[model samples]
Target: MTRTPETPLPSPKECRRLREAQSLSQADVAAALGVTRATVRSWEKGRTTPRGTKRDAYARLLTGAEEVTPHQENPAPALVGAATGPVQASPDRAEPAPEPPSETSSASELAPRPAPELDPDPARGPEPELGSGLSPEAEPLSPSLTPDQAFDALYAFCAPALVRQTYLLTGRRELARESVERAFQLAWHRWPEVAMDRDPAGWVRATAHEFALSPWHRLRPRHRNPEPPPAAPADRALLDVLLQLPPVYRRTLLLYDGVGLDLPETAAETEASTPAAANRLLHAREAVVTRLPELAEPKELHRRLAEVASAERLRAAKPTTVRWGGEQRARHWTRAAIAFTVVLIGATTLTLRTAPDHYEPPLAPGATVYGVPPRVAPGPLSAEELALRAKLKGETVSGPERLVPEAG
Candidate 1:
C-alpha cells in the first residue's frame, strides 16, 4: 500500500487570512472540519495544532484556499509610514518647511478611497492600519503629502472605525462619537508630535478608548442615560456581556480580538506589561464566554463586535470640524490660563503694595484674669424694694441705736 503525503497547513496568520478571505466564519470552518469553534480559534492563534485526520483536513482546506486565492506576500503599505519607519524630511536643506496644505477640503481630498478600491483582495480586509484595528484606507504618507493633508487623511481613515469601536466600549452612540472627535481633536492639536509618533492611529485610539471608558463620563448629564441597546437580541446580549466586563478587560479584548492587534501591541496600547495583558485578555475572554458561550472563539467574538458596532450608525465628526474644534479648545484654555495668571499677578502685586514691610507678630490671644469677675450693672428697683429702701433711709440712726431699734 502506498502512503499519501500529508498536506502541510499554512502559518497561523495565513490560516486566519485564508479563512477570512473565503468570507468564512470560524463556526463555518468548525462545522466543515467537524471540530468546535474553540479548536478552530486555537489553530488560527497557533495555540494548539490539529492532529491526524483533523490536521489533514485543515491542511487540505488551507491548501485549496491558497490555490483558489492569489497570494499577496506584501498586502498593502500602511497609511502613516512604511514597514521600516516614518519617512522623515531631509535636514541639510536650509529651506523653510513647506506650508501646510489647505485645511478646507483637505479631508475630502485626502480621505482614503472606499474599502473596495484600496484593498481589492478580500483576504486583506481585516488587516488593521498602523494602530487601528481597521484597514488602512488612506494612501501612505509620502513626501509630497503636507502635514495637514496627512493628518486629515489619518483622521478620515480612522475616525469612522474608531467611533464604532468607542461605541462598543461605552455602548453609547453619542459618547462614542464624542470620544473619537475629541481624540482626533487632540491629535490635531499636537500634530507635530502625533505625526512623528510611530503609530499615530494608535495614539488616537488609546486616547479615544481612554476618554470613552472614563469614569467621569458618568457625571456628564447626557452620558448619564444609557444609550438604547442593540435592536437585535444577539447583538444586545453580546454588548451587554462586553459592558459587564471591567473597562480594562473590555479594552484589552477589543484591542486584541476585535482590532486584531498582536499581544505585544495590545499590551503596549493598554499600558500593561505583556504578562499582565495576557492575564487580562484571558479573564476578559472567560467573562465573555461565561455570559455568551456562543462567542467562545475569539474570531466569533470579533465578528460579533463588528456586527454590534456596524448595526449602530456611529458616525464621527468631519476632520475639519475636529481640527477646528481642537484649535478653538486650545485657544479657550490658553485664554483662561492667561487670564488666571494675570489675576494671580495682580493679586500678588496688590498684596505687596498694601502689606506691611516688617513682619508683624500676631497679637497674643486675650488672657482671662484669675480674680476678676465680669461687671454686673445695677438694675432698676422693683416697687417693694423701693418701699424697703425708703423705710431704711427714714429710720437711719447711730450704729448702737440702730442695732437696738432693729432688735425691737
Candidate 2:
C-alpha cells in the first residue's frame, strides 16, 4: 500500500522565521529577490503569496540553499539572540551571499528544479533567531513608537487581514470596517498595553471579531454589502463552503489558516484551549476539504487564505484625532479610576450577594453548656454530692437527682 504523504511545510509565518534565523532583513531578502521590501514584507505578513519565480527565489533564500530541495539535516538555528549564542560558522562558510535572482541565481549556481518534497516535521526544522514561539502577528515593538507610529504600523501591517477576517465572520463590510476601527481606536488609547502584549495584532483582532458578532452590528443601518460574487466558480464555492461550517469552526479557521496565528495565539484570541483550537482547525479543514476537493491538503487551504481575499494593499492606520496630553490624559485616568472603583464595588456587592444570608445560627435559643461536669450518676447521691446540694436548699442538684427511696 502507498504510504500517507507528509504535510507541506512552508508557511508565510515559517518564511519569516526562516529569514530571521538567517539574520536577513526584509531589505536583504528584497534586494536579493529583485523585489521591493514591501513585497517581501507582504509575503512574510501573509498579505501576498509568492508565485512562480518569486516563490522559487523566496524558497531558496529561506532554506539557505539554492532551492528548497528534498533533504534532511536542515538546521533550524536556536532562537537565541545573536549576542548570546556562538555563531555557526559552517552555514556562513558553506553558503555564499544570496545573489540577485539572475538571468539566474549564482548562489552556488545550481539549476533550478521543481518545488521540493514537503518536510514532514516542521517542529524539527530551523528555529528563529530572536525567541521561540513568535507569531507573525507581532514584530519587536520599540519603546520609542510615537502615537502616530504605533497606530500607523499596526493599521498598515494588520488591518487588511483583520478586515477580511471580520468580513468573513460578520458577513458585512460596514460592520467589519466599524469593528476594525473601534478595535484600533481602543488600542490607540491603550497602546502601552497593546504593544506589550505577545500578540498586539491579536488583541485588536479579537476585539474586532467580538464587535462584529455583537447584536448591534447586525441591524440594517450598520450592515453593508459583501463583495460581489467571484467570477470563478471555485472561489464562489469556497465561500459557500466556509459559510456552511459552524461559527466556531469558521472563526478558528479564519484565525489559524486565514489570519496566520499559531495554535496557541489562536486559542488565546478565540478563548479556546490549545487542544480545542487544534481540533477546530482539524474539523474545519475536513469540512472545507469535503466541499472543495482541490483543497484536500491543509496547506492548500493555508496557502489560499494567507493571501488575503483581495489583492488590496492597505496603508497605515490613522484614527480620526488623538489628544495626547493634558485634560485628555487626565480624563482617561479618571475614567479608569472610576471604572476600577465601580468594578471593586461590584465585586464587593457580588461577594455580598452570593454570601449566605443567615447569621451563624444562635446556639439553639437559651441553650446552656457545661464542661464534662463532676462525674455524677444514679444509685444514691455520693457524699460529695450530698454536701454540694440539698434538695430543699438552692444548691445545685448534680447527681442525676439522687435516686429516691419512696415509701416501700
Candidate 3:
C-alpha cells in the first residue's frame, strides 16, 4: 500500500520564526512540547533538531494540523524526553493513520490532506501592500503615547518600592527620595537601552543603592540635626530595629523583603554572588533576630519587615512623576543650536562683507562655485608660445603647422 506523506518539517530558523510568529515564548513552546526550555532553545539555535514525535508535534502545532490524540492507534508522545542525546533522527515516517477510520469515514477521508497554499487568489482582492501607510497628517491616531511606553510602564511599576528600598538602605527619608530620583533620572536618560534589559529594575535599584551609599554626602558639612523624618507611630519601633544593622546586611534584607527582588537580584544590587547573598541574607536575619528576640524565626522577621516596609502601600500608591526630561533637554539643545547657527551665519556674513574681492577665472562647464573661487589658469607659456598656441587654433599661423615636436 502507498504510504501517506508526512507534513514537511520546518528548518531550525523556520521553527523559531514560526514559534515567535505565533506569539509563543521559548518557555511556552517547551511546556507545550513537554521538554526543557533549553531543548527548545537548542532547537532554535540549530544545536539540536526536534525529531521523532517531537517533529510531528511541532509540525502539527505550527501547521494547525490535527493533533495525535492519546487514543490514536500510533501515538508517539514524548519523543523529546527520550533519544535526546543528539539532534540526529531516523528517516521521515509516514503520517499516522487517520482518526482510526470512523464508522462514517469515506474512502477519501483516509487519504493524506494536501498542504495549504499561502498565496491568495488573484480574483479574491488586490494583493496586500507592504511598507504602505497613510500620510503622517492623514494617518489614524496611534495608540496613546508610544514613546518610552515600556520604560514608563516599568517606572510606574517599580518607583515606589525602589524609593522605599532606598529609604531602608539610607534610613534618611530625603536622601532616599533624592537617591531614587537620581537613579530614575539616569534610567530615563538611558530608557531605550535599559528597557531592553531582562531586569531593568535591578539596574535601577543598584544605581539607587549606590547613590544612597555614596560618601559625598559624608564629605559635605552637615547640620547637627540631620536625622530622617520621624516615622509614623506604627513604623517607629520597626525603623529603630532596622537602623542598628550594618549597611550590607540592611540593604540585602531590604532588597529581598522590601523590593521583592529574587536572590539573584538581591545579590546583584549588593554586588555579591548568589551564594554570598544568600549567606548575607541569612546572617542579616540572624543579626536582626539577635537584636530583637521578640521575632522568633527568620520568616517572621521577613514578614514583619514586609509589614513595616509597607510594600503593599508603596505598590498601590500613585507614582511620583516619571518625568524623562527629554522635552526640556530638547528645548535647551534647540535654543543652543539656533544660537550656534545664528553665530555661524553672522560670522559668514561679516567675513563676506568685510573681506576684499578676489579675481576668479570663469568656472569649467557645468561647474558652480559658492563663496569661493573657481580654479582656472592657462599653462605657463612664453609670448612666442602664446602666438604659436593661437596658431594651433588657426587664429594665426607663423609657418607650417608641426604635427609632432622635431626632437623632444
Candidate 4:
C-alpha cells in the first residue's frame, strides 16, 4: 500500500508560539506528545524534527490549542512533569497531568514557581489591572502593598527556588543561600526599580546567578575547601560535570536547561549575545556528554541536574531576615559614608588653617668663591720679626755694665 502523504506542520518558532499561546510549558507538551522535554526543546530550537506519529501528534496538539481560542488572553504558564503516552484529542483537551512533589520533580520545578494569578491578601484591597508586559506570575507584587510588603512577597516566592538553583551552580549550600539572600537584599534596596521591572524574578535570578558564580567566591575561606559531594554517585558525577564547565558555559546551560529559561531570555540574563550564549550552551553540553555518555539526551541531563540540586538540603533565610539584613547593610554603609565625609571636611579645614596664605621665595644656595687671596704675606712678616730679634740680642752686656746701660 502506498504511504499516506504527511501533512505539513508549522515552523519551529510557530510551533513554540502556538504552545506558548496556550500557556503550556514544554513539559506539558512533551507529556502530551509521549516525548521527552528535551526533545520538545530541540524541536522548538530547530535542532531536531519530530517524525511519523510523533509529528502527527504534535501537529494535532498545536492545531487543537490554536483552534480552541483565537482571541483569548493566555493564562500564566503552568509547570508540570513529563508523562508517558500520546496526547488524545477529545471534544475538550485533556487537563495537564498533576505535578509531582518538589523533591522528586524535574529541574523545571527547581526554578522559581510563578506567583498566583490572583492576590491572596484580601486585606490589601482590589488591585488595578496589570500592564501587558508585567504578568502577575512574573511579578507578584500588587500595587496596594507597601514597598516592604511587595519585596517580602517576591522574596518568599522566589528565594527558596533561587537558593536551590544557586547551589546547583556553586555546589555549596551556604554560598547558594547567601547568593539568594544577597540578591533579594539588593532587590529590596532597589525596590522601586525592581518592583517596576516586568520580570522581577528574572532580575533576581540574574543577580543571584552572577553572585553564585563570582570568581571572588574562590577566594573565600569557606569555599576554598570544597563542600561534600552528593551521597549518590550519579548526583556527584553530575555535579562534578557541571562544575567542570566554565562559569559562562555553566551559567548558560543552567539557565536554559536547568532553570528552563528560553535561549533569548538566558542570553539576556547572562549579558551575552544570543549566538554566543547558544555556542556556550552547545560546548557545555558537548563537554557534559563527553564525560557522561549516558546524559547525551537532554531529558536525562535535566533529571540529573534536578537530582544534584535536590540532593543537598539548601535553605534560604526568611524574607524578614533578608529585609532586615539589607536595611542594616544600607544603614551601615550610610553611616560609614557620613563619617568619611566628616573626616574629609575636617582634614580640608585643618589644611587650609595651617597652610601659608602667601608664597615665600626660598633663599638661594651659596656658591664657592673663584678667586681667593694666597698667604704669601705671612713669610715676609716672619723675616722682619727675625731681624728685630737679632738687634735686641746685640744690645746685651755684663751684669754691672748691663745695669748702668739699662738705667741710661
Candidate 2 vs 4: which has more TM-score: 4
lDDT of 4 by residue, 134-216 (tens): 23344324468877777766665566556767777888888888888888889889977777653566678788888888888
Residues 167-284, candidate 2: write the lDDT tens digits. 5665455566667777777777776666655345556767777877776644665254455654456656777787688878888877655444434435656777655666677678
Local accuracy by lDDT, each model = 0.63, 0.53, 0.51, 0.62
What is the Å distance of residue 158 in model 3 from its true position? Answer: 1.3
Candidate number of the best lDDT: 1
Candidate 2 global TM-score: 0.45
Residue 192 of candidate 4: its Cα lDDT?
Answer: 72
Off by over 4 Å in 2: 1-139, 221-227, 311-408
Any idea what lDDT model 3 has? Answer: 0.51
| 107-185 per-residue lDDT for model 3 (tens digits) | 2211221111122235554221110111112211123645455445555544555555566666676677677777767
lDDT of 1 by residue, 1-408 (tens): 112344577889998998787787776665455334555675787654554345655776666642322111112222211211122322221211111222231111111111121222356464333223234343346758887788777776677677778888888888888888888888888888777654566678888889888899778798667777888899898889889999999888877666655454456678775456667777887788888888775445555676677667556777788888899999999999999999999999999999989986665679555577889999999999999898888874843253334454
* Winning candidate number (TM-score): 4
State TM-scores per candidate.
Answer: 0.60, 0.45, 0.43, 0.61
Q: Rank the candidates by lDDT, best first.
A: 1, 4, 2, 3
